[model samples]
Target chain A: MNTSKTQKHRADLLVSCVHDRAPDLIPALEAEVKRRGLEGEVKVVEAGCRGFCSMGPVLLIQPDGTFYVNVQPADVPEMVEETLVKGRVVERMTYQEPSSHACALYEDISFYSKQHRIVLRNCGMLNPASVEEYIAVGGYEAVGKALFDMTPEGVIEEVKKAGLRGRGGAGFAAARKWETGRKAEGDIKYVLANGDEGDPNCFMDRALMEADPHSILEGMIIGAYAMDAHQGYIYIPYEHTLSVKTMRNAIESARAYGLIGEDILGSGFDFEVEVRVGAHSFVGGESTALMHAIEGTVSEPRPKHIHTTEVGLWGKPTCLNNVKTWNLVPEIIGKGAEWFASIGTEKSTGTQVFSLAGKINNVGLAEVPMGTTIRELIFDVGGGIPNGREFKAIQIGGPSGGAVPASLLDMPMDYETLEEAGSMMGTGGVVVLDDRSCVIDVARYFLDFLKDQSCGKCSSCREGIRYMLEMLTNITEGKGKMSDLEVLERMGKSVKISSMCGLGKSVPNPVLSTLRHFRDEYVAHIEDHKCPAGVCKALIEHYINDQCNGCGLCLRKCPQDAITGEKKELHTIDAEKCIQCGVCFDVCRFDAVGVR
Target chain B: MPKLKSLDELKKLREQLQGDIKARTDSSTTITVGMGTCGIAAGARETMHAILAELESRGMDTHVTTVGCIGMCSKEPLVDIQQGDEPRVTYGNVNTEMVPRMIEEHLVQGNMVDEWVVGRVEG
Candidate 1:
């Protein structure tokens, strides 16, 4: 370290460094620091995901807790010179609130302020690759406490009193499953950590695994000890290579530290963990299918007549929990059950991590209490919809989950409440939709997704999903009858009841929920042969309004050359040749293009 | 590092590690400079160097670090001085000339340069 000739420097400058996809800003920052000869005076450290991905590459200065967004390489010199050398803040780089016009600090920004980060407490705060950093923040204290202070029975009872449910999708009580696994008559028992997150547009598990790998390991160890499981498996999808690598490293580090492997912490408890990578299949995330895959068999779901807690992973008692669910165990043990139960609603205790994305200003991961309203998640924390668009609906859960209309925005976001509102809190993926989004089109999109992912174990799921897709496609293409609605409702209900696993059962949620909320849009498409949102291609027609200044930008973009007219005059679309592609509507600067 | 043998050992290690991190990051008086794109364009680099040189000569243990932009683009080159748990005082349109006075008043004498303060971070 080059000593600063004047005095020994102590302050460290931390930057939000990006290695994948986004441009790496660390090189420029380092170059500027060196050019100024302030290497030893100011230490530059790279931190992990700052949660505000949209505004990245972000930079946060610690000790004072100042945050900057949308940083470019060219700006590094001035930042280094002024902030590092002179201790003066760059006013332009400071965050200015859109509404209040006040310069917002890191803690004051609504995106960071509105969050209740229980699961994501360590994320974006520490260097994820360093286990020492994790330990410094009180990481494995729970595992130590569980080993020394709490008995196996005591741990289970505390979790039961905490009311922590499975965060994966089903919302089943975690302690209940552990008790079943403990009581089952088996010579060998196993604890399986479900990192196989296959939900569309959901990445809370991926973020948790990447940011804090040891949390999951600590939780698994506690769960393994509580259930008397000697062996464990962490099953992650192949697509999540980062999570898999991080988990593997964490396990090895824990072993080296004697926190895992035989006689952990001198407690005489023997538990070994192995990482299992699986193909990215939507149905593979199902409990039984995951167990089969782990046992080196074809990944397929069997009938759930017998619970996995009794018979799982090659005919042995197994306790399977989601990654987020396992991450919560350590916290519940560290902080007592009553403390955990005090948060969230009466039934749903602890916070839920939601991947808030689509049609929102701030798109990233958010962890809020169970009772946090949809309005708070979308408006307050999300910074509302971008470009001042009105929020139409929010799709909670993944593609298999339902969409709730804006009218029910105040509904509390808990497992039971969301289920009652025609949506399950499956994997905590809240996708917001705006007014321009078509309800029928949204239902068709999810149906198409489910139809492709459906495993052909049960005819009800395989054929039922296909039939529903065909019906939704017909409605969008202006080829639907009034009686098709009744058929769709009947088919959806049957599929929900007769499907073998969670994947097939909840497949019709998108269709059912959209149909229940936006039936008028369906009625308009079928009865009047018109798409209300002007989304369905076959049912809608494009026309040039009087507002057209005849820019000819649309004429150049039209593939079929359906538009006609000279420059600087109102253009016309020939009805016979027009494809109704809506390219003109998107390209028009003066709002000249109209769809009906 | 040796393996933490017991719960008491683990707890003691955590306390020592936290203390080291807290000493560097959570000192009584911390000065943060906003060094986002807008701040650099406004010549915040000169202001920063001036403050650092002043602190070095004075031999004060005051903590100073550079932070990303806080989105106040119109007011480029901002400085925030926070002492202990009190509200953070933000000074805007900061330059090299303002650095010595601000450090002397805020860091040495424990008095804020009132006119230069643009905003205060309230709890």
Candidate 2:
């Protein structure tokens, strides 16, 4: 189809009123539209995500592509009146730098400038529900190609040639798994899309599934063809109602178009997919556990001897890949393997999608080439650490993944570099921590999560992680002995070697890597009983500066009523009652509250 | 919708589809909302409805479309306007109130509203 005619029109305006968690703005904006009585003049439509989230609630006016930042309900009035009413740009509210004196567009922003998106190509572009829209943008063409043009073996060969690796954390070769399942001796080979994304603070898969369900469906259909599998399953958490509905709609749409179910595109292949809702068990994220859950068994994982590709899901050759991984297959086939391989590093091919979250200025989803440096992601793309706070450390992967200290901040992001930096690119949960973060406290938090998540299948993972958690807890509480560090290390090593699955094996990552890099902080906790970041409440003390105006604000705000002072006098914090909720620090107007 | 048989016949059908898509014309404004799961969860559906209702009330020709997540979830209920030289303008965190003024300002006039513009990429 010629896209030029469609492109010839005036630039379409794209805006995100849904972001910033302000849903009421939609009605307010609509009411403002009616109130203004300019009903037919400007076309205001809701588009999917615009991929630039840090500056939300963000506004993008098209043709000019002017990006507005920090938009609110109040700002909407002036924005509609001055710019929309008068046809003049809102100069002050637009994203402008104090030093450059130049307004920056979305592409001009450091956050979105450095990324390339192929798998996510249709995310912000097309109407997900419209088959025609998807078709217009060359969606399902790969499925068409696979069904009409390529053989099962040919499709698998093309995927292998693409060098596509799983984005679902295991970086396993996508083609190799397909080949294994294809060759496996079973009439009931299953292709399962594990959308049961349980990694804390990671929502990339759920976002993709919800945003572009068809892409995942297309990929799964193509995978089924390649693997010669007739049945497929999409496993997502029951809480993901949006994803479930979207996936169901996409499946229905595919079925309606004859893209799925029996004799697809006259290829004489019969395949269909079922969307399975998983219970919210952290262990259900595990492959074995997921398979068990699908089988209506307990959501706990069992010891894995045989690979699932050979024997899985009722003793069938079952292939389980993450949502993001399967979403890329059709693209690889359509664009060719060489095109896919050319984008990312040689070893870890294809772009990886990440949820660039936490304490960072650009908290959005990012898809950079596999080898994009962490410096680029954190500083260039993420707009560096927020609040002028110094960059301390970044936690990659989830709780099971380790944190990369400042020393390795420059390391390129891929499977290997993260592994070398004592972190794993597990499911692409990149959390940037600023200077205010206490390393010990962060370690303790991760350990707490791991302790809760660990499936008790292995004694080393269950009891050993419990022990490490206790030690880390002791250190964070300022009651740890100097020898506790060595004991924690010894225990962490044993857990790493003796654990069952990835969750168990890598549970020691936070404790071990923190001890490896930030041992001095641990020593400070043990020897001096000091939290350098002033985050550890047990070791830190709260005080009121002499600058306090004796305003009762802190005293009132303090849940414990820790502060006591007379008018115009310095305030004091009663240590016994102070709960360290940091409310006083937040409420104090005179900078009187001090944490040390 | 007959189940297509034979890969070659499917190929021919695909070619026919190519022609059909190219020859189509609506001239109606296509409002593609970034209602990806994140957007809807963020409330793009209501934003979409507000725009659709605005166009419908005025009896103006408009086609409201929904797309997947654009990765920038922080700014959602994202709206993309495609009407006539100008690229698509994306408004983040949109609602019913901004619709009338947006229609008056940008839809009728050829001018772009900078305040409602979230992030515009030339590429």
> For model 2, how does the per-residue alpha-carbon lDDT over B1-123 read when each residue is reduced to its tens digit?
654455455455544443222212244466677746677677665666676556545545455555556778888878877765356788887776887777667676757678988865442
Could you estimate the TM-score for every candidate?
0.86, 0.80
lDDT by residue for model 2 over A392-452, one digit each (tens)?
Answer: 8988888878889888877888898888878899899977887778988887888787778
TM-score of chain B taken alone, candidate 1:
0.75
Question: TM-score of chain B, per candidate?
Answer: 0.75, 0.71
| Best model per TM-score | 1
Summarize candidate 1's per-residue lDDT along A1-596 as a digit string, tens digits.
12122223445455553656345478788788889887765656666566676777777765555677777787787776666654566677876665555453578888888899888877777666767667767888898888889999999999999999999988999999999998999889999999988888888888788878888999999999999998999999888888888899888888877778988877888889999998878898899999989888888999878988999999899999999999999999998999999999999999998998889988888888999999999988888998777899999899888999999999999999989888999989888889777888988898888887888889999999889999999999999999999899988999999888888889999988988988888899999999877889999899999999999999999988999989999999999999888888889899899998
Which runs of model 2 end up more than 4 angstroms from their true locations?
Answer: A1-4, A7-20, A24-44, A51-59, A68-87, A91-104, A546-556, A566-569, A588-592, B1-123
Q: How well is candidate 1 docked (DockQ)?
A: 0.19
TM-score of chain A of 2: 0.92
Give interface RMSD (Å), model 1. Answer: 8.3
Q: What's the lDDT for all of these models?
A: 0.83, 0.75
DockQ of all candidate complexes: 0.19, 0.07
